[model samples]
Target chain A: MKNIVKIEQLELASAVVELGKKVGAGLAAIGLTGAGAGVGIVFAAFILAVGMNPNLRGELFKLAMLGFALSEAVGLLALMMSFLILYS
Target chain B: MKSLFEQFEIDLYCIIITRFFDVSITTITVYLGLLMVIVIGMYKVSLYKATLIGNNNWQHIGEMIYEFVVDLILEQVGKPGILFFPFIMSLFLFVLTLNVMGLIPLSFTVTGQLLVTFTLAITIMIGITIWGFRIHGIKFLNIFVPSGIEPWLLPLLVFIEIMSYVLRPISLAVRLFANMLAGHLLIHIIGVAAIYLMQFYFIGILPWICVIAFMFLELGIAFLQAYVFVLLTLIYIANIINLH
Candidate 1:
């Protein structure tokens, strides 16, 4: 009975480790660098827009946000790569 | 780091596998897969041979998809472009399947990968170029020359046209890749936001509504992108063939 219990514990531990590795690899693949850069750029653009005119800031920020999403696409490639590495 | 834009990882399940075989081998695989599906389907059809084609659900749906592709090609590329029907139809269906597959929770969106989109774009570009040259002979070079241009401007116009021609595959690949990637990411963001919002308020009502709205929007986008990709391909081929 004790041996069976130990084996079950071992299996559960391995499973958890496998899941962690999968998640880590996936996270690594979606490169955070490009997204970080995109966010920074968008933030700067928003600040500049706001400085120009506070009233237009909201609309300009929304547009900037869209541009930011487009720019972040580069990071998505990395994300895919990580997933491939982890899962495949 | 706690910002709404915090980076998260996404792993795709599909990976491109390489073999020592040539591209004809891969094409053969696709052909065989298509044939196998048809053969198996034929067997299934035989079992229901007594039923008229339109009376069967699968047959009707299959014919509808076929007719839709045919109509799209005809509408976009004209009659002469019908020769390209098989290639365009296969590409459209394959990409559409892959794109939609990604929306299934935990399934990989193969089209979201640059390599897949780029390969498709390159293949279409190469195939169209070869077809153009084969049909037009050396006159295919005339594609770079604008008619009615003065002799003095011919050289400059050709240069610009050549650049544009070279950019075709890049633009084609980028358009599909951008659309797929952006749409998926947007959906992901909305989903993540909804999760976070659910934690804060009984505003469960609004979050669910937004989620459902976004789901439909993504579905529309998924189909739209596929249509746009295939449509542009037909247009590119039409341009190459100079079909009216």
Candidate 2:
């Protein structure tokens, strides 16, 4: 009986670890996916803004492009951090 | 009871596989998977008689990307750009595809990984270095020396230029890797924030708004980052080749 109880506890522990891993992965995916979608929306808006204002078009376009790059940097950083967290 | 979100903490750096040498195979597999899709898509378009007559979405998107890369090569690298076209186009397409793929739910953002970006940056640097030597031979060494400089400052200028040249891959890799890493993190934070703030109905709106705003911003970023990467590569190659 005691041996069976110990085996059950071991199985529970393994299950918990597996669950933890799944949760961690889920969180990372959610974060990156949202960011990717967010970036797309922002770019579309920038294009619309540029269409509206002819004078600010060139400068705004450049700034918008830079902003886009910066945002992508954030996504990459998050991805790296997620991996670090998962491994270490 | 605790919220569902409270039960989960994202591990951004989670390894899919944890073998030392095995990592290379995994990385290669990811790259090959990407290539397979691209190649298959191309094949389908070319093989289908319908692709010739009408504007299919996939074909249009592919062509648009091709034209954009060509424009980038022409504008930055100039007329001799043909030689570098394949590399630049591949780099741009690969990065662009990777970024867009990251947007898909549950898909891995291959570009978000340092290994991938560094590999690409190193490849570009090596290619340009080789091209420089091939075209200029021993004169390629002159790339370190600037014109219109005082004779006394020649050594200092050359030293600085060489250091800068050596730093190219580092900068290129960091720029791409950092951007992708940061963007994903911001989204994760916003997502967590939105969930946490939702306990208070009024406060919930602000987090949602922020999330919405950032989401749109990231979309533009996906394209711009790819463009900047290719643009810098072209500029670097142009410097090496002295095409201007």
The digit string of per-residue lDDT tens for model 1 on B1-244 reads: 1432222223333445569633343322443355457645754674475265445666766677779889877766789989988788778777676666667764456666677788889888888889898999998988888888799988898899999889887767766676676566677777778888888777756976887887787776677667767877888888888822
Q: Please give the fraction of native interface contacts (Cα pairs under 8 Å between A and B) kept by each candidate.
A: 0.06, 0.71
lDDT of 2 by residue, B1-244 (tens): 3332221233333345566543434544665587669766874774473457666776676677778878768777789977878878777777877777676544556777767789989988997888889888998888888888989988898899889989888778878777666666677777787888899886648888898888777776777788888888888988887822
Runs of candidate 1 with Cα error greater than 4 angstroms are A1-88, B1-53
The TM-score between candidate 2 and the true structure equals 0.67
Candidate 1 per-residue lDDT, tens place, A1-88, comes to 6545677888999999888888888678557676788879888978987998999976685467545544554565566566555645
TM-score of chain B of each: 0.79, 0.82
lDDT of each: 0.70, 0.73
Which is the leading candidate under DockQ?
2
Backbone clash tally (model 2): 42
